[model samples]
Target chain A: MSGQTSAAVAAAAKSVHQDEEELHGLLVPDATDLPLFPLSAVESNFVAYFAPDFTKPSHDHYIYRHPNGLCVVGLAPGHAALRDEGGVKGVDFNVGKSDRSAIKVTGKRKKNAQHFEANTMLCKVSTSVDTYVIRCCVKGSLLEVNEKLVKQPGLLNTAADREGFIAIIMPKPADWLKVKSKFLSREEYSNLRVESL
Target chain B: MVAGSEAEEDLRAFREAVSLVPWHVAKDLISREVCLHCIIRLFGIREPAKGFTSLSPSMFSDIVAELPSTGEGLNGIELGENKDKNDDETNEERHPAPSICSVCFGILQICKVNDAEIPFEKNGVNFLANVIADAVKEEGHEFDSFCVEVSTPPAIPENDLSLLSYINSKYGSESWLQKKPLGNIISLKEALKALVTGPLETKLGVNCSQGTFRIWLTYKEASPLTSCDDKTPVAKRQKTDCNNKNTLVACTTYGLVAENEATEPCVDSGKITMTIPTDGFGNGIAYHESSCLSKSREPCSLSIECYRDAVYFGGRYLKYSRNVSQTCWMIDEERMGVTSVEEIISGCILPFCRGDKSKFHAAGREDIDVRMLGSGRPFLVEIQNARHVPSIMDIKGIEEKINESKSKLVRVKHLKLLGSEAWSLMREGEAEKQKQYAAVVWISRPLEDRDLCTLSSFKDLSIMQKTPIRVLHRRSPLEREKIIHWMKIERISGSSQYFVLHLCTQAGTYIKEFVHGDLGRTNPSIGSILGCRAEILQLDVTDVKMDLF
Candidate 1:
C-alpha cells in the first residue's frame, strides 16, 4: 500500500536535502524501478504479482533487486528477526557488499525449483500511507542480494531498475523468460508515470 | 401406565399434533421448557442412557437458563383456537414466551419428568435424564467407536427476525456467526455437546463425538417440502425427504454443506449434487397438547429407521462407444440416448451396493465424442450406504454387471475395493502422468512416409499453447506450455489423405489444438511439423500410464 513517485519523493526531499539539485531529485525516481509481471492465468484470488529484482549475477546465483523505492522498514523494540549486521537502519542490509547466498536443494520439492507461488514474508515495508509486507510470491532459490543499494540507497531514487537492483532470484530458464517478459521497460515505465499523473 | 409405554404415548401425541396443526402455529405452541426438556432427552446429557447420546447434567441446566426466550409468559400460547393469528402484527412477537402446551403430549401420566421432588426451576434435567435413560436399550454398530453430530432445523433461524434489525443498527458487513447466532440463540451443537459427551462415553462403550463412525442426529422442523418446493429456489441446502417426519439418523461422515449455484460439480462428471453417498434413516414423532402436558409420557413418535455407512470400490472403465461421454452431456437441459461412462457404471453397481448416491472419481476424462479403449482409465467410486460389501465382494461379478449395459456403452474391469488413499493417487496421476493417444488424422494432401520422419526425433520438447476456443468459456484464456514426448505414424491405411498417428504427450496437452493448430494458438502442431494442414477425425486413449493399484 505504501507508494510514491520519484517526483513526490523529490518534493518530500525538499525537507531532506534542500540544497541538493532539485532536477536530479525529481528526474531520477528510484521507487519506479520495480520488476513486475502478470501471470498468464485468470486473476483468481490465488494470483499474486511479483515486483522485485531478478537478475542472474553469475553461473550459480540469482539476484533479487529492491525497487529503486526506499521502504521504511520497522526496527522497533522486541523485534529480533530483522537484525542488520551493523544495525544499519530500517530494512536496508549491509552496505558496500554484493554477495551470493548459498541455497540447499533437497526433498522432492526441488522438481519445481524454478517456480514460486507459495508465499512467505521476508520483511515489512512501511510507506507514508500504509504498510505492506514484501513477500516471496512464489518458491525458488534466492541466490544473491544487491548490497550496493544498502550503502547507496539513492540508486533506488536515481537509477531504480538497472543500478538500483535489489536481490536475485534463481528460476529455471522457462520461468525466467516468463518473469522477465512481464516487466515494464524504462520508456514504458516513464510513459506510465506521465499517464498516471 | 408403564413409563416406557408412556414415553411412546407422548410420542404418538406429538405426531398427532404435527399432523393436526401447521408447523408455524406448532412452532408457537411448543414452549422453550418443552424444547429444553426435549433437547436434554434427545442428547441424553444429564444422565447416561443406552442408545441415546449423553452430555453433562449441570451444563445442560446452565444453558437452559441462557437460552433465548420469549421471556416469562408461559400461559399465553393457544394452538387449537389459532386465536392469535394477527398475521402482520404477530411477526413483531419475535420472542413469544410460549407458556402453553397444546401438543407434544397426549395424556399426562405424571412420569419422573414431572416429579415433585425435582424442582421445576432447576428444570427436570436430573429426573428427566433418568427416565429417558430407562425408556430404551442402546443400539450398537460393529465399528469400534461412535460420534455425535447435531443438525438444527432450518426453521430455527427463520424465527430470528430481530437479526435483520440488529444488523441494520450495527456495523456494516460483519458476519453473525462471529457473534451470537440470530441474537441470543444458544448454539444447539454446544448445548447438545456439553450435555452428552461425558454421559455417552461412560455408557456407549465408545467415544461420543470423537471417532470416525459419526451418527448424524438432524432435527428438522422446517415445513415439509411440497410439490412447489421442487421448483422453488433454495440458496444452500441439501434437501432430502425420505420420510415425512423431520428427524433423521444418518451414519455418513461426508462433509455436508450445500454449495451455491456457482459451484462446479465437485466430481468431474459435471452433474449437480443432490444427495450424499448414503441415505439417512428417518424416525418421526408427533405430540398433542394434552399428551404433551401429561407427565407420564414423553412426546415422541418412534418409527425406527436404520442407515449403514458408505463403502468404497474402484475399477478401470473402457468406453468403446464414441457416442458416449465420461459424464452426462446435455445442451439446454435436453439429453439424447447418450449415456455417460459414470451413468452406466453407477447404474450397474449402485443396485448391488444399494447406495443412495454414488460419486465417481477418475484419473482423467475424455471428450464426449472420444473413446477410451486400451487397458482402461482408472476410477474410484464411493457408494454411500453400501451394506453388503465390507464382506468380500466378487469383483468379477461386478465387472459382468457393468458390461451388461444394453448399448454396450462401456466396459469395466479390475473391479476391487479401494481405500481412502486411492483418491489422492487418482488425482496426482491425472495431473502428472504421461498419456498415449491414437488419433485418426486427415491431411489436406497425400503425405509420404518420409514427410513425417521428423516426428520420431521429438522428445520432451516444450511448446506454447493458448486455451482453445471450444473451452474458452469454461477456462480462462492463458498461455501455458505443455510437452510432447513423441509422435509416431502407427498406420497409413486410410485414404491417401487420411492416416493414423500414435502420440505420447504430457498430461495436459491439447491434442486437438496441437493437430489442428487452432489458428496457431498451439505452436509446432502437426500442421506446423508437416508443411500442410492436419486435423484429427477421431481420438482414443491408447494408454494411461498410471501404475497406481
Candidate 2:
C-alpha cells in the first residue's frame, strides 16, 4: 500500500462505472496461458471484466477464465457491512464472518438436471470493497478454495485468479458429449459485439 | 503470424453443435403462442403445443395474464403444477391449436415482437422491399436483375454508445460478465443489406444477383462523421476514448464515411458523405422504413430523376464526302460545318432507338480530305438512355436507305448490335493494322528508273518519326518508331515532274511526313533515303487491312 496502490483504499472503485480511474502501478495479464471452460456450461445473466494494466493510456482487453475453477467478482466500496462469516441455520450460504469459499461441491442429483439450467449457488466471496454470491456455472465438484484469501481478503480484488482463488471444481455428469453444447466459443463471445463482414 | 489461437478450436467445437440444430423445430424460438396441446417446458410460461402455435386466443391470453404475477419473466417458471386436473380440463373444453406449415406460418402468422422489445422492429424488410419494387416499376425499364447500394452518413448513436461505455468501465472487459452486452446497434452496412436484399428480390420476382440490369439505391441517412479533438486541425475521424462506450460508433473505423474517405478526397468538412449518384438523392437523407418506402423514385432528400443505361450499335461506314470530317470541326470555339459523319448517322439511328445522346467510335480515321473506301472503316455509336430497339426493324433496309439518301455522305454496312466490350477492341486495333495508300508525288530532282528500283528493295524498312510540324501545336512532340511494311511505286508521265506512287505502310506511319521528311524529323524518308527531295500533292487511303467486324 506504500509504493503501489491497491483496492484496499476503497475509493479506487467508487466511480469505476464512469471509466475515470486514478489507478497506480498494477499487473496487466494477457489472454494467453488462461484456463478454458468448455462451451457446455450454463448461460447466465452475469458476465465478467478485469482491468489488468493501469499504466498504458489505452489497450484492448479480452475475456479469460481461471483454469483452476475460480472467478473474480468486483465489489462496491462499502462491502465491510455485508460480510457473512457463517451460515444461518438451514441456509445454503454462509451468513456471518466465518472463513468460507465462493463455490461448493456436492453429490450429483441426476443427469438430466445438468442441461443449461441456472442458479446452482456455489459459495460467497467478500472482497475489501464488496461481497458477491458465486454460483457453480456448470455441474462440477469443488477441489478447494484459496486459503490465502481468508486472512487477507484484499487478494480477491488484487490477485483474483492467481494467488486469490474462489474454488477449483471438476465439471460434473461425466458424459461431456451431451453438456458440451451449452458453453459459448471465444469467437461467439467476441461476436457478442457487432462486427463488419 | 502469432501462435495458433485456441479460440479457433472453440469455434470448431461450437460449429459441431450448430450442425445438429433442428430445422423448423419450433414455430420460432420466440415464445408467442400458448394453448392446451402446448406442453409446459422445464423453465417457461406456457410454450406453443407440439406441431401447433397456439390452442386458442383465450388459452394464450390466460397464460400471459398469469405469468408476471408468478415472477416468471425475471426467473424460471414453476412446472408440474397442472399435473392433477390435466386430462379432463384441457381435453373437454379447450380447442387444440391448428397444425401449421413453416412456409404458411412465416407468411400468414409470423408473430411480431412484443411491446417490451426495443430497437427491434417488425416488417422493416417488407416495407423496404415493396418500396424498391414499386420504385423500380416506376422506372418502366425491362430488367432481369439489379443490385441496391445504400449510403449512410455514418453518424454516431450517442445514447447506445454511452450505455456500452458504462458496461466497460465497471467490468473492465477481462471477464465474461461484460462480454455479452457490449453494443446494441449492428453495423450500418450489415443492417442495410439484411433489410433490403431479400425484400427486393421477392418483389421483383427475380434473384437480386446475376441479373442483366444493375439497380443502385443510395440512402444518405446517418449524421456527418464526428471529428476528434485534434488540431490537424484537418477534420479526420480519429478514434479516441475508444474503450469507452459513449464513443463506441466513433471509435469503430468501419463506418461508411470512414470507408469512402479512405480512397476518395474528403471535402465535406474533412469528412466524406456517401457517394451521390448521377441523379442526386433528394435533399434529405433516408434510413427509416416509413421515410424510405413511400418517398419517390429517387432517394435523396431532393427529388431524383432516373434514366436507363446506354445502348450500342457497331457497323462499318463508308464516308463518300472528302470534305466531311469524322466529327464536327470547331475552330476558336465556333463550329465550321452544319454536319459531320457522326451527326448524319446519329440522325438516322436515334429516331429508331429512342436515345438522348450519341457518341461515335471507329477503328482508325482518315484526314478530312481523304474519303474511306474498300469495306469502309469499323465504327460504333453509343446511344445513351435508349428506350427501345424494335425487333421488326430491318438492319439491311436501313443500310440501303442510308446509301440512297440525297446527301449519301456516310453509308453503313453490317449494321448490327454490339455489346459495350467491343468498343475497347476496336480502339486497340488502331495501332496494329497495315494500311495501303494511293498518292501523287512531286520530286524536286529528275526522276530516274534506277532510283525507283532502289525503293522496291526497301522492304520492311523502319523509320523513326517524331511529331510532325503540322500537328505539333496540338500534339506533344514525342518520338515514335513506325515500319513501312512495303511500298509500290508506279511511273506516270512526268509532264510537270509529277509521278503517281502506290504505297502500302503500317498503321499510324504518317505517310505525308515520310515522303517529305518533315524537316528531318522523320529519318530515311523517300527524300532522305533516295537522295531526291519529294512531296505528296494528293493522298487517299485505298485499303485498311484490319477486320474489326
Candidate 3:
C-alpha cells in the first residue's frame, strides 16, 4: 500500500510541473516565436522609407524612423548586396579608419556619439562572391551599431530587419526635415519594388 | 480679553497661592531680579493664575514684602523696588535699573504687539490675543476652533534651569521644599500657555481644541549685544537660535558638559555633576553665577503667525478636451498642451480656500490626447496655509465654477472637503485599481468573425512589457508584467477595418502599447494575436475601478 501511494504522489508532482510549463508558454513567449508574419518586431514600431541607387546603381538601403527621431539603417530586401550567392558570410564595423562599434556612447546625452553624413560608411558585409560597403543614408549623430551581426553573420541572411539592423542615428529636427522628403515612403517603395520583390 | 468678574476671581486665587509660599525663597528670587510670574511658577504652583500676568517688578516686591521674612537682613532686600546695587557693574551701566527678569528674560514681564511695547500691566495675554485676532480678521479666516503654538528661545530654558537649581541647593531641606519639591515646578512654556489660552479663546470667539487652525507665537531673546559682537563664533550664535525643544529638554535633564563649552561664554566647569538639571537641583554653586547677569536685559521680540492646516478638496473630475493635459507638462521651456486639468480645478478652489499654494493629485492620469469620459477619475487638491476653509455650499460653488468655465475642459462631481488622510487613500488605490479603456483600432487585414472571438477569449492574460520607446529617455529600462483582465470588440456600422476595442486592464498598463505591442516588447499583444499590423487611433478612459469618491 505504501508503494502505491508513493507512485500516486510522483504522478501528481509531474502533472504540476507540466502545468507550470504550459502557463509559462502562455505568458512569456520568446521574441522570435511572436507569430508576426513577414515583418520583424523592429519593423512594426517604425515607418519604413527607402533610398535607392544612391551614388551607385542597384545600391539600395532602408531607413526605419521611429516617432522619436532615431532611425535604423539597414539593407533593403532588394539591395545588390543581398543578391550575392550564399548570402552574407561575414560582417564588419571597421570599414572606416576607426571601428564604429568600439566607440563608447554613454548616458542620456549620448556622449562620444560621432556625427556622420548621409554618405558615411557604417559597415562592410562580405558574401561568398564579393564584399559590399553600406552607407548611413541620413545625416545625424550615430548612436549605436548593432554588434550582434559581427559575431553571427548568418543573422543578416535570416532576419535582416530584426537582429541584423545596422547603426541607429539621431537626426536633429531640422536635419530630419531636410532629408525626410528625399526618401520614398513605405507605400511608394512597395509600388516601385513590386516586380523586384 | 477675559471678563472683569473672572479676572478678579483669578487674582484672589493667585494671591492666596502666593501667601502660602515660604517667605525666604520668594525674597531671595525677588532680590535676584527673577520676575513675579517666574517666582510663582518656580514654587510649582499649578493654579489658574491668570490675574498676575500684568504685575510689574514693584508689584511683585509688594507681594513678597507682605510675607514675614525667615531671615532679618532679607527684609531690606525684599521691600526695595528692584534695587540692583550688588548686580554686575557693566550690566548696570548699560541700561536703566528696571531691567528685564534674570530668569524669564521679560517673556513673563512684557508683550510686544505690532511693533509697540505693551508692558505686563496692559495684560500680555490680552495684547497677544488682540494682535492674533487682528491678523486673523485681516485675512478673513472662518474657523470654529483653534490651537495655540508657543516657541521660546533656547536661552530661556537654560536660565530656568540655572535659577531653579540655585533655589534647590540653597533651600534643599526647607519645609516649603518638602511640601512641594522643586521637581514639581511648571515649565515657563506651560505657564505661559495656561495664562494665554483662555483670553485668546474669548478674543477669537472660539473654543480651544486640538483643531487644524493654528496661532503661532514665537519669542526670541532680543539682546543687541549678542547680535553685534563680532568676536562671537558663528556656531555659538547658531546654537542660541536652534530653539529645538527636545535638545533643550535633553540638555536640561542630563547636564551636558558639552553644552557649557558650546553655549556659555562664561563657562563654569564645576556644575557638570548636577542631576538632570530638569529636577531643579544642582550639586554646586557654579550654576548660580550664570543667572546673576540680570541687569539691562531687554524683553523678547514676539512675532505672531496664523496658519490653517492644508485643506484637501476631493472629488471625481472629467476631462472633455483632448488638448488639456493631466498636469502642466513642460519640455525644454515649451508647454505641451494649451492648459491642464490641475490649472482649471485649482484655479477655482484656491480663491475659496485663500491658500498660499495649491497642489493637484489624481488617482491616475491619461495622456494629453486621451479624454476622461465616464464617471471620471478620483482626485484631490491640497491647499497649504489656507486662511479660509470652505463650507459644503462653498465647495459646491467652486465645483460649478470649474464646470461652467468658458473653456469647458473639465468638470467635477461629488466635491467635498476631505482630511489629509484622503491623499494617502487615493494614492493607495492608484497602484492596485483596474482601468477600462475604449480604443478606436485599425488592422491591416479584414476583421473576421474569428478575430473578434480570438481577441475576447483572453481572460486574466498576463504579458511582459518593456518601457515604451516614447518614455525610455527618462524611465528606467525594466520589464513589467501586466494583466489584461478581459477585452471585447464592437463592430462599427459601416467599417470592417476600424472598430472599437474595449479592454479592462491592470493599472499602469499602457493601452496604446498593448495594442501595437511596442515592437514586441509586450508579448501576446492584440497585433500579435491577430497576426496582422494593428494601430490604436483614439482612446478614452471609460471607468476606473476604485471605490473612492
Candidate 4:
C-alpha cells in the first residue's frame, strides 16, 4: 500500500508540473520586432492619397483609403491649418445649426447619414491665431467623426495620422472612381511636397 | 370492445384492484372529489392496473360501494349526490365540472371532449385512443412507431401532494401502517402515459418505441379559478397566474409551518418529507377544500400534436443557366434572376416529403451570371417535420425528376438520403475548400509567350483583396489576403487579346475583381501584372474541392 501511494503521489506531481509547463508556454510572448502600436501595420493595409491646395492654397488633406473603399480623412503634414503658433486648441462639430456628431449611422444601410461633395465642410478647428474649416476631401457619405478629439485637441498636433483622424467616409463605387484621379499617390504626393518639407 | 374476453378480464382486474384500497382512505378521497384514476395512481397501483386505464366515474363509484364500509359516518354525502346526478343526466355523458378530480383537473378523467364529455358507458381506453388516432391520421403522417408524451398543469402535482398530506395526517397512526405513508406511487404524468400508450398502440397499429416520431398530448386547465383574474385582461394564457400564487402559498407553508420536514417544491419535493405531514397539512387541506369548491366543473382542455424529426437529403447540383442564382434573391420586391437553384430543387422535393418547410444550404455560392459546370457544388436540403422520409429508391426518382426539369436551369447528381451528420460534415469543409474558375479575359495589349510563362511560374501568389464593390453595402469593410494557388492560360487559336484564364484560388477570393482589379481594390491583379487594362466577360466555376457528395 505504501508503494502504491508513492506511485500515485509521483503521478500527481508529474501532472501538475506538465500543467504548469503548458500554462507557461501560453504566457510566454513570441519574439517579434512589432511594436504595441505598430504604424507599419496600418500603412501596409491602407494606401495613402493626398489632395494639396484643395479649395484654397496650402489647405492640404490626406485620404488614407483602405482596400475596402473606406477612406480615413485627416490633415496632411503640409496643411496650413497645422502651421499655427499654438497648434490646434479646440475642435467643434457644430459647423451649422445641427451638430454633425449627433447623427447615429447604424446598420449596413447607413441610415440617417447625409451625402457630401468633395468640397463640403466637415468641421471647424480653432487655433491660437485663426480658425479653419476642414472640408471633406473625398466625395462620399460621412460615416463617423472622431469624438475623442473634442476632449484631447492636442492629439491632432502630436498624432494626427493615427488616433487623431478626422472622419471616416464610405464612397459609392462610381463616386470613388470619379474622384479617384484628383488625388495623388503616396509617392507622387511626397515628391511634389518635397520643397514644402 | 373489439376483443370482448380480454376487455372483460381487464375490467375484472381493475375492480379487484379498486377493492384493495383501504375503505377509509377511499371514502375520504371521494369526499374530497378525487377521480378514481387519481386515487389509484396516488397509491402507485398504475403498474399492475395498466390494462384497464379508462374506468368511468359511475363504474368506479359502483366498485367503491362494494368496498364494505365499516362505519355509518363514511357514506361521503358529496360523492353520493354526484353519483345520483351522473345517473340522471339524459345525455349519459357527465359534465366534468362538478366532479373533476381536484388533483388532475380533468387529464386523467379524459372526460372533456369538444366542451362535452365522452359518454360514460363508452368512456374507456378505446375511446381515448380513437380521439388521439383520429388526430394523428388527420395530420397525414406515415410512421411505424411513436412515443406518447404527456404534459399536465402545475396544479395536478400540487393536488396530489395535498391529497397525500391529507392521507398522512388522517391515517398517520392507523393500525394498517407499520411504517410511514411512503410507498410505490407512480406520478400523474407516468400514469396517464401508461393508460394511453397501450390503447394508442392498438388503435394506430403501431408499437410504442423510443423513436424520433412523437405524439404530444398537452393538457391544460382551460380556465383557472382565481379571484385576481378579473383585474387582468384576458389574452389567452396557457399557465395562469393563479398557479404562481399557489406556489407562493406552498412555499411559505413549507418554510414556516413544516420547518424540520420541509420538502422541495414539486413532486420530487414530497419525497424528502414523506415521513411527516406536520401542521402544514391542515392548512393545505383547508386551502384545497375552498378552491376545489370554487373551481368550475369544466374539464382541462387537451391538444394533440405530431412531429417527426428533420429529414436531410445531400447531393451535388450543376447550374446550366447563367440567369439562375444559387438562392432566391429579391431587391425591393422585385426578382433579381429568372429563378434560383434552391427553388427548382426544393420545389421538386418538398411535395414528396410533405414537410412543413424546407431549407437549402450549399458549400459556397457563385454570382447569378456565373454558371456552375464540371463536377458541381455540394449541397444539403433539410425538410423539417417531414411526414415521409424518402427511401433510397425514392431519392433516385427525385434525382431523375430534377434533372429532367423543363427549364433545364439546374440538375442534381449523387442524390442520396443522409443522416443528420451530413449537415455538420458539409459545413466543416466550407471554410477551407479550394475553388477553380475559368474566365474569358480581354487585355488592352496582345498576349505574348512571356506573359504565359510569367503567370504559370508563380506557384502560390498571395494578393490583398477588399470586400468587392458589389457586396460592400452588405459586407463589413476589411482587407483580406487570399492565395491564388495555381494558374494556367489557354490561348485562343485566332484571337490576340482574348484568352481563357483558368486559376485555382482560396474559397472566398473574388474572381471577377481579381481580373479587372475593381478599380485597384485588389492589389497585383491581372491588370496590374500584365501592365495593361484587363476585363473579364464571362466566368464559370470549374470545380469545388470538398469530399462530401
Q: Which candidate ranks first by TM-score, i.e. highest?
A: 3
Q: Model 1 in CAPRI terms: which quality?
A: incorrect
CA lDDT of every candidate = 0.45, 0.45, 0.71, 0.73
Worst 10 residues of 3 chain A by lDDT: A26-35
Give candidate 1's whole-model lDDT: 0.45
Best by lDDT: 4
What tens-digit string does per-residue lDDT give for candidate 3 at B423-455? 889988889999988887778787899988988
Candidate 2 residues B1-549, lDDT tens each?
112233233223322222222211111211322111221120111211111111222333233333433321312433222221223245224534222211111112212212111111123245445656776677665655665543323232331232222223323233332233332333333344544565567778877664335454433321223442222211111343232443333433322112222333222221112221111221111112122122221111211123445667888887766688888888769775556888788777776666667888887788776666655788888877555553425556666777788987777878887777878878788778888776666676667777668887778889998665455433444568999877766655323345556678888888878887654557778877767567766566766777677
lDDT of 1 by residue, A1-197 (tens): 23568778878888546533532232222322311221111111112222322221110111222221111111111112112233223234321221122223223233222233324343332333333333343344443334444455444443332333344344444554555456444344344445322
* Candidate 1 residue-wise lDDT, B136-168, digit = tens: 223323444555544443322221211212221
Q: Write the per-residue lDDT of candidate 4 for residues A96-169, one digit (tens) a residue.
A: 65687887776577787778888888888889988888889888888777776889788689767755678888
lDDT of 4: 0.73
Q: Candidate 3: DockQ?
A: 0.05
iRMSD for each candidate structure, in the order shown: 24.5, 45.2, 11.4, 18.6
Worst 10 residues of 1 chain B by lDDT: B268-277
Poorest 10 consecutive residues by lDDT, candidate 3 chain B: B225-234
Kindly report which residue stretches of model 1 are placed more than 4 angstroms away from their true locations once superposed. A1-197, B1-214, B219-310, B404-406, B493-496
Interface DockQ per candidate: 0.01, 0.00, 0.05, 0.05
